[model samples]
Target chain A: MRIRKLIPGVDANLLIKDAGKLMQDPMRRSFLRGAASLGALAFLTGCDIIDGDAAEGVLRKISELIDGAQAALVSRTKLAPTLKESDITRPFPFNAYYTEDEAPAVDPATYRLEVSGLVDNKKPWTLDELHALPEVSQITRHVCVEGWSAIGSWQGAQLSEFLKRIGADTRAKYIWFKCAEGYTNTIDMPTALHPQTQMTFKFDNKILPRAYGFPMKIRMPTKLGYKNPKYVVAMEVTNTDHGGYWENQGYNWFGGL
Target chain B: MTAETMTASQDAPIHPGWVRICHWINALAILVMIGSGWQIFNASPLFDFTFPRSIALGQWLGGAIQWHFAAMWVLVINGAVYVTLGIVTGRFRRKLLPIYPRDVVADAKAALTFKLAHDDLAHYNAVQKLLYAGVIIVAVIVVLSGLAIWKPVQFQELTALFGGYDFARYVHFAAMAAIVSFLVVHVALALIVPKSIRAMIAGR
Candidate 1:
């Protein structure tokens, strides 16, 4: 069959030899050609194997390398930019794996902060006791791994002071957090000791709302939001990694900003 | 002339062997970066639309980030080498500099009419120089914004240049769009004049 000429000066038959190729425009054809190139690159790098487990294994290792690069860039002295009170995002975004209503409700009356593993004190403490420690607050941007951010004021106990109070083995590599919602996460010791890292008890001068991790949240402005676990029920200072909920599912553990 | 001299005298290859190698490697790295970056962008889209899933590289956000970071190394190092070699060999001056606006306007008009000649591979039309030069600047912007997002605190000055952590993302996306535009035109021209593609591959 003869094809209709699409352009006045050009014959359609000359432009495309096959009906299959003709169906798609040149731009789309080249875009798909890019996908083909994606396959070639995947074959060469062995990391984009979307259909197989082999790809995940390679990609995960590369993620670890990136984590190292990010970690190396971090300086204990350098702090994430602090925002003015006026800069705070009104109704800061509520984000979680579950719905907002589903956020874990840990009664402040019953909440007991458990401490263990390489700590001089393994004793549990009440929320009231945590509140009594010297208080601090700062307005800072909370960067999420998913590529969103919101500036908010957070008030809490300095993590370094608390760690020192418990005589936590600060030399240990990690500080693992267990949350009331079965969420878990870990941060390196330097991050644990970062001036901005806090055992946050309040958001915007009020007790943290459930959607923002009621009772407690570990706030690390230098790291992505996921690295800042919320509704933290327990913390263990340890050398072992004990990868968290998202980390095990393939999110990079470092997750630095 | 003797046979050896005769062979040497034959139309010399337009692209050097180093240029061809760098060109291909850079192309592959860009594909990986764009593909994976789109997957990441899909996680929490900046705009209303997202790049289709088929066009994205890695299957998931973490996986995409992995590809993005891995290809980042290749892109950075290869780009550095390309720029260094471009300077050392004066490829920049000879092929892509002194792009007069008059020439660009004429060439653009020729291009739109499909009258621009690409058969002569030894010299580039004004449009090609403008694009090549513009894309290099865009590439640098993309990398800088990426670093600002990656380590905002350590690279605070860079982040501040783009108006801080969140704003840097916009800059990165804009730069990516610019690059994709360049690629579309580049690949389209390569299709229109297939010899350019052959010359790129065969260093002729």
Candidate 2:
């Protein structure tokens, strides 16, 4: 605290020597690094709330302005957050899903994603059976709403393959994925079948992390992290609509960033 | 008047114009990075490892990335140049050599107290020395954590340094806060002692 008052003109030379002393000390360097890191985290915590409030205010004003206008840009009944492609799956920088679970004992020879919605056919094709149909692979970035992202190559069968196999009903508009963890998320059918969207079984040139939905995980290159449900277990083709876990918690259903 | 100030300025000038330029330029780069970094941080609010602040909006998140990446290059390159020059020219040893143990302990009091604020460009007071070293070290951590988050695949080991992506991000944020605090104090001192600020700008 005493150094707080050291005005430069008083002792320029001594100040330089003192600086030299501090720099030469290893213990001092470590202390300063650790201390600075702490300080930055504390400040970030405080600022988060302030910015969140500002965002809420902006959203409200936008909604109010729309209500007051004669020719509203979007109908009140149809006013929903913009559906950006990037919002499908956001990535977290360090949340790698690590699991040691072996591939399911369910023999791949007989395992198949049962496509049963408004579809015409309701058959379960084996792994080879599905692979016999077609393969889909894509390299895309997974953007997490928590402010982290990663790009990886994903390879698997296309969701539309199963949909077409079962003969998807013409009226079905949403594709819901049921994960092994009982987590469920849905995306518009067209978006689900986008070229970049894949029902990936391999990640980064390796077998998928079991925790990452080893058998399969939905990869929506454009959405936020949460939207890409891991450990996917089931698929539901539906005409109705619903949101994922985080989505119901006030998070954007389509987190593009 | 203070012994600390008298002793510091007693010796011949040690900080040359080049050294001074490097010093202030480093500070400028850091300040811009911190300010813009804050604007970008607000996008995803995390605190105390608790719940996240939900309200978030910013297209400037991308802008933040640009500013940070740009400022980072400046900090890294300038810092590298400064260190290289210091070592090559023996300026590091000549200007930064520590005083004896007795004087360090004795003057440590005045140095800590800034009772030695009589001259401009006296190099760095004991506390200033500590702080300057500190800011540089923190800047290093910022770069490391940044790399971890930026190219996780390519720098998987680097990412592991901060416990992974989320933690690396946390570390990066924390480093910024520390640097900002140092900057705040630096500015306050400059304003409090106009002579120092003038020296920095006019290069006396």
Candidate 3:
């Protein structure tokens, strides 16, 4: 009767019959015998349908738990699979919240990458100056969160190398990027230092086209496409959490693939 | 045992509460997963045509992913419980295992020609055993491949085992198709033999 009261709207007689059946079934009895623990009961109660902000808060906590678990599991040394040049998707489909024509056009002459926050250098580097840094290229798959993928060749300076050049605090928790299109995102320090996390300025062996985050994009093969900010014009390193556009919109903050 | 003994077995309790409860829960979880997965796939369809919006659970990609990830935990936990209990109770051995090659061929022929036996609803024929076994294996693969795709960098070894991220997706989609086909046959057979469904629900 007390259990029926706790379960609210359920028919008490039906619950009793099911419980009686469970007791008679050896397999079910054994399975559920251990489930009498308070923790299991609490978990089941938590999963019950509830109303309003309380339920939303529970869901958010679950998401946060998933994010923490995923963050813990990421490996710094693991690399996204790389494909051969011939394997690249020809005429790679462009994807964004906006159409290709709506892509922001930044004037190359005036474009300067500003570095600040937890960095010794607060200077701005022009496209030429950033491009002149040591270049590295890789042919890796760009995996979109939306269930499609495209292989493309990306060339740029390693983000870790660039971070060091800017005299950034390597121990900082996050490396946030601000793009010309008003897009902002952040990556963990380990991801920021990953060998494949590049400040990409070239695609298919040419200056990055406007369609593909021209001027510069953080080409993070290790992360989902959304985590890789494009047209990045400013960056900051900080210990405080700065949730990204999609992340703030309920997408997983880690956004690792 | 003789045919009489086999017939008598049908009257005895065959479906346990664990099996029945887990079965229905798994079915519900899988249906949610499939619908949400289709919604997610529709966001970036591999082929030209898109999955109809009517059958999809969540209208948007973000909402679909939430549904997917939520259902994923249910599927994984329920499936794990089923598998662990099956192995522990030796139910798999008693109900579906050691399917001989001869039995399979004979069963296949009998099934194709509509000569399959249903006198003992409690017992599994060689074909039924094989299908059940195959589905369990495929379910495990689907879960593992789903994990690999979900966290390629974290589960790098698992992803490498499936060849790569793209190949992992291929495997996941293919496994889903296999499960869907199995569901079709399973539901059809249940409809053809409504008694088995009743036995599952009431533990006759």
Candidate 4:
């Protein structure tokens, strides 16, 4: 093999001698006894080990299977563990692909939550109207895909209640979010209706700071940090899979973790 | 010597088919998992430093995650099969078990004093048995800690057992470090006793 030349000081004679010894080993003969059965099992499974692309396709299929299995296993009614006020991570670290200074500044006066797709009421909601609805608060952990977590109290209207008022088609498979910072993402409908899924407007009993996605952020404690959209300006309920910002780039769509 | 004479001399049964297959598969899976895990860890850079991108697989975080999850299935399934077969085939009892406290103490003394018993290359020594058993327990901890972090809400009990989300991450990272340490010792030992490496591969 061409790769053999890459090793600096390996003796070909010694290697050949080792191979000769291995072939002569009686244990090798016994181990090979099950080789026929293994070959049959491989053939029965219809796996083409020789085709590289087909192997990759099989891996992708398995990934999709895992996603489907995770989705099926998740309980919509189960709430994420809530934390005490004292447990809230102080100064909740700002996380985004960009630095803190680059956070998008959206004007509250002109900020309108746009509603579209698979909904009877397509009316845009202002900040006041969103706050007017019955509100809930939760101190839940925000789990990042990067292996860090922080707890922060978030106050917002229930996403389900908002969907109800907006006359969104609850039967839709996905609810997509368009953020002012140019981030786009989608979540499964069941996750959207999860009790902990909130259309958060307040952080720590105050107006959400710019670093924390002021105006609105979708808080999904049941999911990883990326699944939750910040600076959300538009939402679309639809059966089509819109795929998220990170998700489209190979992150699992069903990021229920 | 003729081929028949050579075959007769070298023909000693060592590892079974299942053990050899699972061992290689597990080694490959762990390597991929660790490399990709380093890439994933680079995203947030736990502590003040980041894992060097040059040594890690999957340059992008998303790609790293895909690799991690994919290799995770191999690790889980292969590990399960190996453990189950070890128990069912009585390999655990015959080969791994039967280590007494005195045997372990004597083995440790010999090992520390640089007097390894190389006479029985076919069987595991007391220290080898204990280390292997310890690694298996560590593997279980790694898997459980991984699940706790992966699905904290669903596996809330596991998260609590680890003390919380942050502590779970700590445990997972610590377990990975322990596995790496084990690998270092294992490779060193293999190099010291090349016959055992041949025995593992050729099963004699």
Candidate 5:
């Protein structure tokens, strides 16, 4: 009674009015009492809710929608945090769908990076030619979709500058990459043009090792680790999204970090 | 006619239609988010222990991500509507505000002793008010930390506030744990006071 006095919604008049009905129809009241859980179960199982393939489709649609949302959220001026050389995770973790030993072994001298689609220069690029392009170094975190992160010092040519050098159509919607290991991915044009996006040829000031995607890797600091394809052998500027490896398997296509 | 009028006039529903609708939707969204989130947590667990697959939703990491991202829109939009309507209708103020700490201690003592009067299903004791308000805040915290984790670089400042990309995962999990705790208590109370369930369902 003392505690009831402090309750915000307690009304003595309402309680008193309700008192007479409490014991009048005991059996019916007991049945109604038992119905509460049943009612909730029924509500949950209601036909209005979706299920099976229909539910999966809806979830897929929403995941697809987030790609647009992530695209909008991305800003060129806001770069992934650049870390000091000391901050680079030692022996930066090697990650791929396959084991590290199975990473594509490409002969650096013979490798040629094929460029196609909406570009004036459909010419394939050699490793020496890629090296000839101006280079910049960046130390940034590579955040994985599975929820681990590592910072690595990467050296490469700015992808945006390379696009200009290749005369790739800037209006193209996507920049698709194919790796020597058969890994494939497509990133949006804006992300491709992000200043920090690199067509990496070196790691820690050395020719990129096979463990690090070797011949070449396109590093997008703004994206998840999987989005950064290594052992890159071919690239195209196209309006078409030639669906990616993990993305086709239900991962968000954007994979924006 | 006279009997019907008397019944109608006396037994007004405690929850409005919008409140009940939002409540059920929120329940579904929260369940999906938590279940799938548990599965995602198990992929690269922060703690030593992992949630069992029996309790978690989604078969694997990719599937878990799809459900988590999918249900987020529903949770966020429904929660917004619930909060907006609660404030607009003055229900929050009338039902949950003026929660005195003194009353909370007294009410908690009564509850422990099984002497608390909850016969009035519409009126909330101070403890209930605190839990309801607190859970709302915790829900918001989870969403923000999730955003920070989802696009840590894009939302770097937000990530930094929660500590960093790695630590934000812990913040996200902690907020989820808080929500889960609230649900446990809330469900227990509903079962204990079964009439509250009817009040919520029928809004009476």
Candidate 6:
């Protein structure tokens, strides 16, 4: 065979001779054994060649090598402390709660989001009523459990406004968001009133389309897309914990980015 | 010399020096990759927002990626060299091929039933050939899927090949698991057939 040229011939006599040589030469045997040991060691350590870097110094380097790699790593690492700080990490898709019907179209005239639930002063406010309050806009990423993401600028009323206006009960532990389409998603009060969470009416400098909830939407940058429900119809302050649609579908309810 | 002596003299050694080197190197590379990869896949390490802990595992995402990418280059290059040498020297034809399906099935049955004991290196039985082929093919898939995920925006078609980025990633991880399992079996067989390891190193 062609490979025979690369090594010596293998006759029965040769095989016996080779065995004798290995047995007789304890030093050579030990050396070969050492090589084998190193091979095993390499496997356990996940040798450098598998890692792509050949240089000994570069092998131990932890920092990113390329600019793009640096950018990607830094961006991902810096995005949120919640991911690193949160005690829980789930691997299922997030499921938010919602009624099985389309949200009612906003009747700008008679439309007023009813702020009830655990609030002391339950009242209804017109679209103008909410818009008349201070608004804040910020560009942030919407993380999805499906392993996709998008960044968009969101504009709306600070959730703190409604919480303060309705005089939320200090004992309330969760916030239930009732959408115009009867979609409901509940969140921890602290998470709901997070500075980043808002009752958004505009996205990317344009009024959200009906599909995206024309009159109003909820933006929770730290949560998955499912947690940020659209067509928010009402706000309910509650002490009991509840899940959204995707949550019931075996998805993580928190949906933190 | 007698006819028996002449016949014994005619049998060539099973493993060659180049092939042995390539095999051992690849083994070493895979070990490092798996260990580091486990560490890196853990970054962010969650399925969605609500539940926690998908499979009971650890987080080593950064470490895994770093080690994974590094090992990837090695596996690719070493495999490339091995294939090139195999083709150039016709070693592949002599040992890997000419393995008829009937013979392969026979050998596989023998191997599975433990009828073939260790040190029986009569031209790499059919199962070995299939395993060799599988490793090569799966290695290629791992690299391609890896590229797709590593640069999803740039390698759109590659990502689409194994489904979208999410599905492609799942495939990539699954392939890694398969290769690791194969490695375990390969190693066990090598230990049982100790002569095989000796032959690999001594080129006998």
RMSD of each: 10.6, 18.1, 13.3, 12.9, 14.9, 20.9
Would you list the rank order by DockQ, best first?
1, 5, 4, 3, 2, 6
Off-target runs (Cα >4 Å) in candidate 5 are A1-52, A73-77, B1-11
Over A1-257, each residue of candidate 3 has an lDDT whose tens digit, in order, gives: 33222112223343344224333334331321222122212344444323224433444566678778777765666887777999888776566655567788999999999998999999999999999999999998787777667889999999999999989999999998998878899888999999999999999999999989999999999888889888899999999888886675546777887
What are the clash counts of all predictions, listed in order?
A: 1, 52, 1, 0, 0, 34
- Using TM-score as the measure, the top candidate is 1
Pitting candidate 3 against candidate 5, the one with the higher TM-score is 5
Poorest 10 consecutive residues of model 6 chain A by lDDT?
Answer: A1-10
Model number with the top DockQ:
1
Q: Which ten residues in a row have the lowest lDDT in candidate 1 chain B?
A: B57-66
On TM-score, who's better, 2 or 6? 6
Task: List, residue by residue over A61-98, the lDDT tens digit for candidate 1.
Answer: 78888778767756665888898999998868777665
Here, model 6's chain A TM-score works out at 0.59
> For candidate 4, lDDT tens digit of each residue in A1-257?
22221112222233333234333434322221222132212342433532334533454566678898887887766779998999998878777765566789999999999999999999999999999989899999998776767889999999999999989899989999999989999998999988889999999999999989998999999999889999999999999998877775456778887
Ranking by TM-score: 1, 5, 4, 3, 6, 2
For candidate 6, the C-alpha RMSD (Å) to the true structure equals 20.9
Per-prediction DockQ comes to 0.29, 0.04, 0.14, 0.17, 0.21, 0.02
Give the runs in model 4 whose Cα sits over 4 Å from its true position: A1-62, B1-12, B112-114
Per-residue lDDT tens digits for candidate 1, residues B92-128, read 9999999999999999999899898876787889989
Evaluate all candidate structures by whole-model CA lDDT and list the values in order. Answer: 0.81, 0.55, 0.78, 0.79, 0.81, 0.60
Tens-place lDDT per residue, model 3, B48-73, is 55566566654445545665787788
Clash pairs (backbone) in predicted model 1: A257-B150
What overall lDDT, based on C-alpha atoms, would model 3 receive against the true structure? 0.78
List ranges where model 3 is wrong by over 4 Å: A1-60, B1-12, B101-121, B160-163, B192-195
